[model samples]
Target: MRKDLHEANRLSWNAATRAHNSHKGDQAQFFRNGGSTLFPEELALLGEVHGLKALHLQCNAGQDTLSIARLGADITGVDISDVAIDFATQLAADAGIPARFERADVFDYLAHAAESSVDLVFSSYGTLCWLSDLNAWAQGIARVLKPGGRFVFIEFHPYAMVFDQDWTMCYDYFNTAPLAESGVSDYVAESGDGLAVGEYQAGEQDFVNPHASHEFTWGVGQVTTALSQAGLCVARLDEYPYANGWKGFDGMQDSGGRRMVPPTGMPRIPLMYSIVAQR
Candidate 1:
């Protein structure tokens, strides 16, 4: 991964971090009231994290990190955004959750991480797209996991990323270039997934971010192959017809609660996928 590319993304995430938090109004209070930002999909995948040393990569603001800590895991939340780590640190303190937050490039953190150290490596939602080198990411994951340790991951299907928000096929699934996007932080309009499943709704905030982002897309096959090459056995690969929390496409229907499914009459396709790789 080029340092300049990652640095640009880091700056962008730093600028957008506050906007993401604006949507989740008063998160410190939310956690203090015993609220969790996790969804059922990830919870089922991360079954029984108690007593495990868990690492959460790309943990923006640490909502899910604190949630996992509440589940009895000794967890560390990591992100590239400095503002995000600061906010997460304060949130953990305010919520009285025992956890650690570190601001570093995922690859850097993984490179320096003790080998065979963590019991679980977890990430979810829009994680893979931020990675510039899949091989390095996979190797890092394998290096940090204990023998028999699991890497539980759920991410937006690459197939779904080929389309624009208006249901137009605007991007190539196999595109290899770093996609450059300016003002990519559309935080105010975020919806479709939350702790109460949008029951405790907060009105959209007027938000703006000036930084740009650089992102990459890796196919499911490529991701699984990387993990295999890194000496991790792929234990499970599951595809879901619906996406949790993110409503990126137009005409998506709420399948009760946070699950967002394609509009009626649309052909079924994988919108999200999960993988369990054991080291």
Candidate 2:
């Protein structure tokens, strides 16, 4: 793993957690009020998860972890950010929901997991871009799963990620290069309000309020190939023309409170995708 890149991205997400958990416009309140963060697509794909042993990777703030637990699954949430994990732990306790949270790099945690011990390994939206290596990720998912265990993952489509927030083609669809940005704003802020909170340097230059994010793009083929090479059989692949929420987009009409798809006369695109793979 690229430790440098991981550390850089971790700092940004750690900072993001603060804003996300505190902002009134964010889902923290909903989660605290016993709302499920699990989207409809993932819930449908993960039908009947009751009484399963589940592992939620990159489970920021433990909202989804608690959601799954509410569905009768024994869940353990893992995240790289210590601050985030701390918050998740407290959130779970405050909500009187039984959950376990660990702070560690996902790769390291999976490396130490008991072989064939987990019944299901899950992750969701905006989870894939932070990692520099997808093969290792798939291998980790395979490593922790029991025979016939399932790996259910949902993520923003790589093709959709190629566009900027305005849906304009601004980035390379097939680019493998890592992207670095500074002075990042909180993505979940109802408006452009919250800002990054630390000092950072991108060389000899130093800046204040510097939140740094480093992300890598992986293609659809890359994702499927990695899962296949990791010994997991792809049981189902579903593509959706909508995202769970508006991603700072314009001209998108809300289908319901939970979904936003392209309006009429607009060319459709795959905004998100879900994969169900089994060991």
Candidate 3:
């Protein structure tokens, strides 16, 4: 069950949820204002979700979940962090969006779901990193999905994740080892404030959080192969040189307020990738 990994990450994310919900950014504002968190690329891949029964895995503060519900899908979101689920539930209610949120490890949640009951399984950026097993994850996606149901996912490319902030190769692309680190930053805002659960690292750090996290690296091929092995047909795969979300790269610039483009003179790299699969 990866209990230790789950516990560590849960604490980290619980801390992150607090900061994220209160941060005064477009993400926090948009969710509070009932705005959609989805970008154009995934939205186009989603096609028509009207009236579909969709399950959003690792759904953080329900911003994206509510966004999908606004598209007319019967949405249910699941996350490992109880704090995240609670905030998501409250956010949905405040947004007047009818949705459900459950705090459970995604694998366990999918295990108990009725077979072939869900029309769609969805997840987005920074999701797969928290997972230790892609094969089991894909199987879960296949388990709850109705026949011909779709799995839409987008994540930071492993190729891009291997590099550090300075674009130096600091990590392995195919490393299966659990990368553990303390004193990480909250992406939602620049300050941890009440969210810090551990001692913040001194000297020029990003968003500060005391909690530690465990992450695993999986390559693009591993993801596709796992989905295919789990009885899902790969329908589409796309890679983008720019990212829809921040990746903590130095000197990256925004592209038309939509994507974060790499700095000038830097060699092109795949910052993100997407996959659409059918059960």
State which candidate has the highest lDDT: 1
**What digit string (tens of lDDT, one per residue) describes model 2 on residues 1-279?**
687888877887787666655543334445556677677787887888888999999998787888898898999999998888998898787777888999988888898998898899999878888888899999999989999999999987888877777778899988868888673345545322211111111221122325778888888889999999999999988898887754456666666644667667888889889899999
Rank by TM-score (best first): 1, 3, 2
Tell me the number of clashing residue pairs for each predicted model: 0, 0, 2
Clashing pairs in 2: none
- Which ranges of candidate 2 are over 4 A from the true structure? 24-33, 190-209
Q: Order the candidates by lDDT, highest first — what do you get? A: 1, 3, 2
Can you write out model 1's per-residue Cα lDDT over 43-156, one digit (the tens) per residue? 999999999999999998788899999999999999998999999999899889999999999999999999999999999888888899999999999999999999999998
Per-candidate local distance difference test: 0.86, 0.78, 0.81
Question: In candidate 2, how many Å is residue 171 off?
Answer: 0.9
Instruction: Evaluate residue 208 in candidate 3 and report its C-alpha lDDT on the 0 to 100 scale.
Output: 65
- What TM-score fits each model? 0.94, 0.89, 0.90
Worst 10 residues of 1 by lDDT: 192-201
Give the Å shift of residue 263 in candidate 3. Answer: 0.8
